[model samples]
Target: MSRAAEAAIAASYKALKEDFVSNLTGGEIGEINYVTAVAPVALVLWSALQTRQSFFKPYTPLSFAVDFLLNVCAILLATTLYSSTPIVLNILLLAPVAIIYALPRPPLSKKPKVPPPKTKDADAENPLPKKPFLTIYRGAMLVVTCLAILAVDFRIFPRRFAKVENWGTSLMDVGVGSFVFSAGVVAARPILKEQLAGKSTALSTRLYKSIRHSLPLLVLGFIRLYSVKGLDYAEHVTEYGVHWNFFFTLGFLPPFLALFQTAFAYIPSYAGLAILLGSVYQVALEFTTLKAYILTAPRTNLFSQNREGIFSFFGYLAIFLAGQSTGMFVLPRKLSSTATTGTEQRKRLVLTLGAWSGFWIALFMLTTNYKYGLALSVSRRLANLPYVLWISAFNSTQILCFCLVETFFFPGVYKATTAKEEKEAYELATSRVLEAYNRNGLFVFLVANLGTGIVNMTVKTLDVGSRGAMGILGVYGGLITALAVGLDLYGISIKM
Candidate 1:
């Protein structure tokens, strides 16, 4: 083809791509509720199978298949094939099967079991507790994120499930916010621990560490910006901005929070900061010209060009603080907290996390009410108050469900038990595949992004039929899942 012909073809493809993702209004909140329910149910189903000693076993090919089906394929169906149906009803219909598998099995023999070996004061060390539920919840967020990034390219994927153009809620939008919330959950762990231990560090040292921690993400953001521009890749510019990307948003948050390091001394302080930031930002958007500027301002300067990313940082920061607040309560107890017995901690975990979830969801409903409240719409573009609350509420609820499943089906997991029994129960309670993803989440996410690029460059995603799209997605998801599981089985963690 001639140079002009090639240029014309490229232009056509770009137009098609841009048009494909534009002007999308997201689905109802009720539908999202049903869709998000699939992940926890899958967790229950997988653990139930393991507890039953069914054909599924940890780290085996069969287990990998089950994990993929439950985690990957199940999500695909929820978002696409079964989207119109009442998903929660299907879950209820299948509850019996899950219960049967979850029921305790009788021993195969009447022979006495071996007694646990005793050690000398080992339990006194008071190690931090294992949080299988948090791990699985983060893994679920990553998995859903990976799936949406690629699947959105195909025709079979619903436009409503994509990120809304200006103001609305969607699965992909939730994915982005949940990812930030999830990261925030563990971001300040070391800082909080240090405060608890009464250890003081120099301000310069804290600043240095925060920058060092966020440096990789900043570099990745730059890399994405250049690669997309260099390859002339399809991009939804309004999603972030002319040059801004999601990585940039994720990168800036760490250091920003680090500036408020003193607040880490008190957990509830995070809640206060989050509320203040979110509410103040919302007021600015509402009462001032900021919202109009973000929506209609010309992009003649660098700041203007990336106004969405720059302005939305505050909203995301609030969401991050909210996550930190939730994490302090829902995460495993600290060393000082080890005095609480497992059963009591379990009860407290359920109630506290449940209360937080209810609080956020209630706040979201009030703010979104057109009659009685602020009457704001959720906007991922702006990362407004409703958006932050929606993300926190959804993720908190999901995490609560994960905790309940872990506690109910694997009661001994958190109890004082023999090392061998604990190991077995832990394995039974969580998916090894998800554990792999949790172990090296950043690496898996990077791999998925690279794979999506390669597939998009090679395949005509818009032209592909539903069957073809499914096949390509299956292979892509399978490869990514296998890589995570393989690395985990070999005890390899590719951390920065």
Candidate 2:
């Protein structure tokens, strides 16, 4: 073979080898979720820019042109992930955090609207109002976040984004895990509430239910693994087996933690359990040859496929337990927090999240530096203390920023930017948009996955340049988003 061909072959082999160790050495990005992090603020800010007349009415030619241009800008900004320096991405993504607080808000009403007197029965039954806006926002975030993460994974974006980079880099792969985990955390809201209400949540019963719930995923994961073999596109063999976000981590978490909660209700906090579990893993690594076992036997049993999907469950379950513990503290305050002024409730929530973020940051540093620690970068596979702390810190901080945008910042911007008489119509449009997005988040997620697969099949992604790849992603994402919104508006909800 020619010398040039040998070098090329060597490069391909190195790339293949990297597929195995990418999680270890990919150099994780801290702001991996920058696109997701900025979305809530962007959505609200965009809504604020709408006029009452145009909000309720269909957009005119000029308005449509302007919105289209701005949306294209947004899409490129989100997907290209190109920056001369990491700090540029940081400043661009973090701009909203600073800018939101600076926007002028409407003055408080001279006559504060009085609530009807709480009768004894009314006080007894304080019904939670249906928060359409928040619901829509979550759905949108899920769809958009899922799309962006998948795009990077498919090599539709910059290569650096598919792995970890500096803290402020947009859409790190590790950060993607946190985004997925956050949804799981949110989904546990009801379970957390049940535990807090002093309900008897037996581990056995929870385990049985979790098994039933996870059975479909068990079937699907195997099927997906098998089906992708003949396809000419990229496929991560381990990803479906144990590495996918929705697989082993989620499968074992509920029942495993329920067992712990059942046995240890006497304990005051999840912190103790987290430390104990982490220590056990750390010690086991010192004493055992499990790493060798995993590398040698890829699919030996149901428990440890890809070595990580199973082992990471311990760390993920810890995260879930911590989430429930957090719910115990956070949900009650959220329920009782009534805002007299726009910022009051939001201020309280942000402060709480900020405190938790700081705590997690400190824990991450301490744990990561544990002599055995600084050697490893943050890992989604292991889901260890450093990984857990890094995700928690970022998720808390970003979610707080999102809350600020939704609660005080965007609302203020809306009022200040629009006339008082147009308020009702503007609200109506925002509500409708939110409801549309909220109604079919799962549908859109599936749609995006399907679209991604189809696009890969239809086009030579390796032959495509960054700009072309981004354009493809844009059209694909736009189509899915539009279809989802349209179907939802027509009251077509494809529920699981």
Candidate 3:
């Protein structure tokens, strides 16, 4: 080939790469919300299916396959083939299917004998009631994240559902925010336990522990940076800045938050602290030059090159704090139950979560209202006030829904009277596949990232037809599922 022709080909490839992910404005709020609701819808279906003895009882391979289809493949289809479809329509379609499966079977002519409780007790030994909702919640986040990371590369994937260049909400935007919020919610327990216990560790000790826990993420961040640069891969520099990745954002958070542990111990209200920090950060953006600096600064130095990640750290911190507050607030109490008290406690827990969810949702609307309030736009890049509120609200609401579904549909999981029944109900209510994803989420994510990179490198994802894209996604998702489920069956959890 002529040298001129080779150079021209290279230049064309460069332009194609840039245009693939550039200058998006994101989708409408209603569309994003509708898509997000798919998780709960899938959950309802899974719950309904689990209750049926005639269906996949005793946890066979076929049962796991069905679980994967309902939880993972359904989501993939929703975000791709049905990306434009209304969520309500999907729910309407799924509701009757769930109801049919959920209908009670006619009882056996003779009642089966109740087995004696197992002598080696696990649930009995553990005092705290299991929180299945949190597990499902985390797994849902992972599923969406794994899907979006690769799906965005395909032409069939909705462009509006991709990350926005600046202001607006999208499915990917919600994915990123929910990821951080869920991380916060999970990390909250440890922080709360330390702070609320009135225990003091040496500053050096806390810092060391925090950094130790964060080192894996930092190393992973560096690896990603090196690989992307070395491979000359296509990238959106503005998404996380030239050198910054999400791993760095996650890695830096722990040690930074550790600096405030001593202060947080006496502060008493993590929720208030979150509000104050978020408000102050918003003020700085609106009233000062920080916003301009973040949005327009030239990539002249390390900080400038990574301004998005650096400046947005404060906002993410506020989000983490808010999650911590939520974790503390929702820590289940060992309430004595009666007809009245059981009903009251359940109502109170659901109501409080619902109220907080409503508060944040309303706050998001108010802050973004054009005529009534600050009229601020939501920006994941900026991690500004509306972004924080949207994330908190969405997650709070999702968590609430999960709890409600578990309460109403899968109540037997909690109400099992004996060890044998408890074990069976536990298996029924929980998905082994989702449990695998939850247990090895970070590892699964790493594997998915590698898979996405391999797929992109091997194929022109943009040119793939809907059928071709779906085929590729199915194979990709299958590999991920296989890895997760295999590890889970062997009882091997790879946590870093």
Candidate 4:
């Protein structure tokens, strides 16, 4: 080979090596960005097709335009991993491109709002039930208390025994376990209420309610307990720690949401304050020795590795709460004439802010020497202030982008056969995204965990060559994605 060709080959090998190391170490962005980015594109394309006018014939041109732009932007951002320039520059270049493509242009003409089908009519008077403040406060207390018990357990027991044997199993135990427990109790509420003929029955009802309400609390405890255990187990098991950390965290989400709704009723600005406080807390934590201290002795202090600690839990809660709050804020508002008039303009504004914020946050995270290992460290908790801030900012930006796409670009995507269909689709999408969150999200995550475990036990065990490994990964990933997409399309089945 020529000298130049040899140098080129060597450089390519070096990049591949870095990528491999990053993936093994959990440093690389991996397939997450692609999956998330693709979902919205698909939704938008569907919307375009569903809404096309009869006169327009095939809307292939517009579909192709949107798809081309979305793919191009996604490629640019994904490939920028190999670039030497700062992440800020990459974000700057990529965000605008994505936003521009995503901005909703008016349909050739305004189609009259199709009155929802008679069978699909929402009961205007029924309304969603009001969430109560006491419920949220009590749930929070339960989570805190459980975490406290786990902390005590950790201190008393040997580290190895204290942890769960299988992270995936632990997640299944906690995540699915909580859902089953909660659902069973909730389902029996009417029977339990009828049996309340006396004070004793009343007392039983109260106790049952508390357990039902705090199911999320129990799930959170299991997640923390087992996640830490999974990390330890990974030292031996390597590939299949059977860890479903995300599911464990998410199992608590529905109750958490219920609680937040109740709390928000009392303190309307609480959502905003949560976001502000979380952001500030994260930023402060990042710039100090706080990060190092967290890793060194996470269990020694109240704020240490405890996932349900006020600081860490609330920080993530802020994200979830913010998402819910935004939905609540938008759902009731009749789109004003001004909003409709400036749809394109407002979209540009949100996109601009999202892009700008995303740039700075991405830059900050990449530059920081934070370890990107696959094993989640309770001690080296990235849930600390800086990591929290970065993830929060990124999450918020993405949510905003998602909302804009839904609002302007894909308005009718969720309009299915009935009101229930619409409601379910929205819920499922939100749940899927939340499943990917670091804390307090459950259902879709069980799918991820089981998928990971199956992959590890099967294809991952093969002594494949590089090409073979790539092929295995491709097939495995394709199958998993297809299965997930199918389940999502068919309606998420929350398995216990």
Candidate 5:
């Protein structure tokens, strides 16, 4: 009860404080966890190593580097700054990315990539491509959105704004919506092409394939539900569902689009139907007052929450149609063929597409104003008329801008004249790191979902600070990127 006793107690208190500070600042996120990222990172690291000197095409070093840097900055900004940065900075950073992309792409100096050897599923008619940066944009949006949602769900970010009634209210909402929208467009490409080409897109074949693809997604969804419900992970029912089969809906949606394509072959274009049907469906939802029901009621499961999958499918399908139509316009052209005749073809194509994009943007603004903002939300759950229009307009403009850059101003995706040309083209133009991520996006998405669950369980995400949060996201994103790149290097992809 004297000086020695008092000193002992003071020392114990100091040690405890040190430990608490360590846990907060230097827990699981203190260092880059290489184990978590795996072989995919290694594969990308190798590719990145080769391109470390320069990512630009061999001849046009400065412009290519600038464009690539701008693109990376935009994606990085979207990833780290969306929730934190000023609105003006977001506009300033993003506008230039779009402008750089909008500038005409320069002529290809290298040879083109050979189309993958023909398989049963290959489309041999048209070739030549730039990086599938749009899907990269979509998937990156999904990845970023999911990461932010995890921040909230794991209590790394506070739960102050997680609203149930707000339609596409958060980045979380847009994240899930972008994934669905991108999938719809990419998944339906072949069928849409078949329809346009007047080929017989057999329903039986597509139907069977749909069921096969949906099965895995359905299984994965169940696994996710179990992980959340069975494990003591943070609850995020509305992100997708409490027990709703969200993946099942995604799997089922594309096949439905394919079947619809067969039946509605008379419909002139995917874009027309997207704008028309999306608008009408949204009007119906509003007129019937069904929109409100769908938004608020589904608290427990899929339908209990106002026919969640059933109703949202209509809006999403419209997005899918719009995506398909956009793909038709942007993806089908051989940029080399068009760009060979100076910038006239390139400029004209850009103007025409840009005009169309402007038309859609105007349509979006008009609808939003007239509907009094009812149609403005990019809500994943509602996916109403406004949401479809918003995404379509944005995507259309992005495609126009990106194509212009690739076709006229930049020369990253060179056209192949022969097999040798294609091989050389890939070696010269490919950002194996980015290309890898873009190609295996679905797999990367699945990995991110699983990784999120694992991280929450193993680490005290709630204990993480802002620096640690960035570290966690960086590690997770890097892991997914690495894996996707690795799979691509192995000539594998998870298309379904």
Candidate 6:
């Protein structure tokens, strides 16, 4: 590593170690934890931005190469250092490094004029209408019915009907329901149109914005699919599983969220209801034979088991609804001159409560599940209420952390730079970190899986002794981290 790069790495490690110590010692570290947690994401984002910006600069290739190398080294260092740490701590330490990279540079002195709001045309008809409470209740009930179907397959029905085969079938049913629900919302253009028209619409425009904003991701996904399928890169493909699925799943989330937003607009506390319902259902599922039946089912024929039913759909839909409902009330609005100060304060207060609720939900999942690794997988049957709650909680925490840091600490960071300027100086720095998350999140994850697979594949062939095996394992860690960073830098795009 270059001296500058080495210094940066050292500083990052110092910060992370200090933060970890503070946590261990029960120090009164407040925002410092938050700051550290956001660092890695910020770094990846900066790296991506840098790479994109370099396209216009003369030294684009060199910039990419340097950033890629730095990221690889950073990842290698992190993996080697934290391999022995607890999984939670390892996960937490990544945030600080990402945040430091995302920290803003000194601002330019010139301030831009704030633009005025556009006037709406008088003839424009509003698309969204106020709905009766029963409409929302019925919608929620439909979701509940779906959950009930899945529950039946999990042996919740009459004892004579109970069988292990029912579990697998239920999983498939739920998966199909999830896909269908996702499709249904994606097709609901008129509802989306109306939601966008209303000034006080409960739905978050940002989710819609992010979905539209991620067109590049879809293109990238197709390109990757072509590369793997057409070019026969399957032989050389290192990170297959982790990269592909996330792109497709994220593509589905926005429209699905929008539909939920519209559906729950009238329900005063839909998120709470969704959480309560989902958690109760999950607890019931856990206390019975549901766990053994669902987890041990054959992986190849997921639909053959009884667990492939509609309740899984309800559980996930509840999560989707929770995210949407939270977003409606939680996301902060960009300050506009027309909006009164009270409006902003009220919004902030709502967001604060929403954030706390999300945190508690996540904490509950971490404590309740003895099967920690099971939840990390992508099985729809495994994606019961607890899984939904946990993932939603984690996802919400990330969003909240990002928003808080950006709004309070990194205010005006995006506004200060044009896309072009950001691309030049900030691209590699930002993009590198975000590359970890972008369209290839699942693909990158698959790479990690492949790393584990490779280890398993070589176990018999290598025939190494215990000490040698340990050494090989250590090297594998470094290689995995390097490959992850390389893939992240090359394929990911950073969004501000």
Q: Rank the candidates by TM-score, best first.
A: 1, 3, 2, 5, 4, 6
All candidates: TM-score? 0.89, 0.71, 0.88, 0.45, 0.70, 0.43
**Highest-scoring model, TM-score:** 1
Give the whole-model CA lDDT for all candidates, comma-separated. Answer: 0.79, 0.52, 0.79, 0.36, 0.54, 0.39
**Runs off by more than 4 Å, candidate 3:** 1-24, 54-56, 92-95, 98-128, 192-202, 331-344, 414-424
Write the residue-wise lDDT of candidate 2 on 284-343 in tens digits: 643454433333333646655556566666667666655554444444323344653324
Cα RMSD, each candidate: 7.0, 8.3, 7.2, 15.9, 14.3, 17.9
- Residue-by-residue lDDT tens digits, candidate 3, 1-496: 3566445545654454356435347888788778878878887777766655435465787888888887788889889988888565467548766566657774645657877645644334432445677788888889889988999999989888989887778999989888788887777666545644686678899899999989999999999999899988789888889999989988988887787666675777776777778889999988765676677655778988999988888888888877876776565432334423434655677888888898888888899998997888888888998888888888899899888987787766555555566566656677777778888999999999989999989999999999999999989998898899899889998876
CA RMSD (A), model 3: 7.2
Residues 1-496 of candidate 6 have per-residue lDDT tens digits of: 2566445545654464345423222111122232223234333343333332332133455644554433333333222232233244435544544554565644435658877335442113222221111111122212222222222222122222111121211222222333333223223333345546664444567466757845655665565566445644322111112134333444545555555555454555546656665666676655654443343333334342324333354565566555544444332222233434433543464376466556646554464545862232122444465445544554345445444433343223323223333233233223332333332433443454445444544454235554554455446534544554565557553341
Q: Positional deviation of 471 in candidate 4, in angstroms?
A: 2.8
Off by over 4 Å in 6: 1-81, 85-194, 199-270, 283-289, 295-314, 326-332, 335-354, 357-381, 414-496
The C-alpha stretches of model 2 lying farther than 4 A from their native spots are: 1-37, 40-44, 47-76, 81-141, 153-156, 164-172, 192-198, 202-204, 230-233, 238-245, 270-275, 292-305, 333-346, 369-376, 410-439, 491-495
TM-score of candidate 1 versus the correct structure, residues matched by position: 0.89
Total clashing pairs in model 1:
0
lDDT by residue for model 4 (1-496), tens: 3566445545654564355433232222323333234434433433343333221233245533443233222222222221223244334434544544466654665669986556634323312211111112122212212222222121221132122321111111121222222232123233323423332334445455645755764675575457557644222221111232433344444454444434544666533644565556655555544433332322433333342333334444554454343333233212233443234434544564466457535643553435752222211123333333334344444445455555553333223334565454343223221121212213333444444444444543334444554344335333433444345446565433
Q: How accurate is candidate 4 locally (lDDT)?
A: 0.36
Cα lDDT over the full model 5:
0.54
**With candidate 1 superimposed using the best TM-score fit, by how many Å does residue 87's alpha carbon deviate from the native?**
1.3
Tens digits of per-residue lDDT for model 1 on 419-442?
555556666677776787888888
